[model samples]
Target: MKKSIQLNQDNLEQIGNHIPVPNYNRTSETADIVHIGVGGFHRSHLAYYVHLLKNSGEASSLCGIGLREGDQNLHDIFKKQDHLYTLMVKHPDGKIEPEIIGSIIDFKMGTTDPEAVISQMAHKNTRIVSLTITEGGYNFNPTTGEFNFDNPDIQHELRHPNDPKTVYGFLTAALKRRRDAGLPAFTIMSCDNIEHNGDMARKMLLAFAETQNPDLAKWIAKEVTFPNSMVDRITPVTTPADIDILAQNSGVQDAWPVTCEPFIQWVVEDKFSNGRPAFEKVGVQFVPDVGPYEKMKLRLLNAGHSVMGILGAIHGHPTINACVEDELFAKYLGAFLDEEATPILGPIIGIDLEDYKDSLLERFANPNIKDSVSRICSESSAKLPKFLIPTIQENLATGGCIKFATLVLAAWCYYSDKQADQNGEPLEIIDAMQDELHKAATATSSDPLAFIRQESLFGELAENERFATTYTDMIQELYKTSEVKKLMRSLL
Candidate 1:
């Protein structure tokens, strides 16, 4: 029996008893943290944590700010429900735990009204400006690992500081106001998946700020704090069917409900300019340094995804679970984690590497999540550098086993060049540097080093005989044989 209850502040109490709703007073809450790039991950991870804290009567709320024109859809969906949405955690055995999260008190889009968004960021009550912008959003040079100051958006920001478009622009404008008004600058926490995310955010933001206003940039540098955080949880892209399923199973009609796997982890550095919620009481780990934990997640979990994503894509696997369900694929991924990725990492204080690796395999194999392989495969140009390249660099420097890592890189070359599986099925290819990658990969016969020679992404890896030799060999074998599984078996 499906009950009909549209999700909103007015109807939170009306939602069926099966679904958990916020018990606190929503009317009195104001924005404490202004989050940029609001989407599924934000809802499930940060918002989910805030919802938990608020359940304990914590005085903190999230004000989501969407910066892009594409974010208008966010306005359409979140505004309808008074920024209320259901988070449905899909367990491995097909059970769901639905909770109505009320941590987000307001949502604003810079696309509609930039002034409102800037004002919200500059407000006295807004003590933190956090972000979940994806890896490429930083606008940093992937090779040199520096903030790209010449980016048109940065230039546009310098030219017209008042009318801002990019996140950097908005932050610069708002920070200027705060400085001029003599209000203390807020903490700039980055919950994105990048390693040392807070540090990277600080570097990139400061670089942009330096270009426009050197004096204000110095003030921001002196006063502001950026906390690096390692956030984890697999929240797949929400589907139309997800909405319907939530309605059917939980009887909560949320237009853009979030669905994710059961597990979640947040490790934040204990550094903030303004005060932060007592998040540690609600399962958030606040440590002195988030470096070890972040490196483990990035090199193991994120890198593991790329190992399977590229190989599974070329073999025509539709979803991550389906791909891992294949015995050969599973074996190859496990060996890559055990033999290649795990070797370079230093031991963390509390974590067991073996347990973490096993858990990742189980997480990827969760049938209920149906995590998309193509979704994992998206933006490999950005992902590979952050995830896999570190392992490669570390191995090459230490003279460790580069076999599995090299093969994965070669597999990516094939995936990029063909843009289709062996059976001629078209793959869903999405990458920022696709044109350059495709061009370099297709020219492998004449210039075996062409792909890795792209200094922006690969740096000098192409010059290294050991890596280039294996990459060239495996790439040739892939094009010649096209038996992706057999290739894996041979490597194993």
Candidate 2:
């Protein structure tokens, strides 16, 4: 017989002895809003907050939509368990607390039934359509944050509008349907890690709409609202251990489980088109402006990760905790944040750099959360501009030191080459620039300065004499040292 779908109260009470459960409710009624990209981060952060609001009898209109196709296992599990799953939050102090979240009422595979996605988007009751689609899904140019219209997906969608091919196409078709039916435009809230996420979404949507209907694009610009947001949480890829723990604690088998660190934050702009749920009651900060918050996160938190990911991975550290525990890695991370990142971020308001740095260290040292260097280092081309280059440019503009920033660039160049270490083991090079980087590394060039002058990669930075000279010096140092850890120690 199949196991019953019920939580063991005895087991819950036993675990309760270890971690105190906050008096937050965890039951939500049917949902009215729909969320795209139901990944680990969404499940741990947004879904948990929505569940709390539901349990507290505050918001009853929030549903989720999972986008991946051919994933019947996840759909079946949610169906059998009444759309409920336990989110295990692992605290930095090694405490685990499991709470049943029930805000998701349904799931639809967009690739399987595209019409169904369009139909749901046309629904008048669906007031907000939030997206957690990662940076790559946006079909944006890394150098220019604009939509890539020449992409095959966008081209296909343009040729065959009836059968939508991309997310942007589906959104435009759905909006067209709403326009014909006289439904109000839903607010488009982006919770991705990209800088100015709201603005990016708006720009892409408008660009897609303008291809066929300029009037529609204008109307959307005026009618729809895209609120900028800064979201923070260390949600690692789920492992087999997480599955076993969840099944043992919750008495329900979840096919797609998520585990995350205890730290969570969501800062959103206070703007909406049709209507919005009362998310403020569940700890979402609705501020008049989110620029300062966005800058703080994009620079300090994300930039710090970029600095540690390359250096730590070179030292053969797998997880963030492993890197933080190493004395050298810890000190390098501190210097990068304090001396390099913070100096450029001094102009941003509403940010306590010291407190934020402390919180970041604690989050990184969370042993229970297994964040991987490979995951953080992926898509460096898209991430570097948003996280690192802006700080570099700011420092240069203000006559600040660019030594550490140059070292970071040099480390990124070395990481992208996909070389082997002293042990002859292959190193993982995670980035979209893999092919280009390989070509650059293997080119017949003996001078490090010539290598730094690659226009395709550095753009205007290669033309700047001071920046190029510094980058050349770092590249030479890296080649001579041949050890990322040693180079980092010397710089610190």
Give one digit per residue, the lDDT tens place, for model 2 in 1-492: 234244322233443443332233334333467778877888898887777776677654445565556345666666665566668889877777766566676776677787887888778888888888887767777666668898887888877877876778778888888888999988888999888899999999888889857888888989889999999888888888887776665454555667888888999999999878798998899998787888889888898888877777666788888888888888888877887688765455656789889889878888888788888877777677788887777777788777776787877666655455424467767666677766675541375654445554455776777888888777777666657777777777
TM-score of 1: 0.98
- Alpha-carbon local distance difference test for all models: 0.89, 0.74
Top-scoring candidate (TM-score): 1
Tens digits of per-residue lDDT for model 1, 288-324: 9999999999998898888888888888888889888
Task: Please state every model's RMSD to the true fold in angstroms.
Answer: 1.2, 3.8
TM-scores, each model vs. reference = 0.98, 0.90
Q: How many clashes in each candidate? A: 0, 4
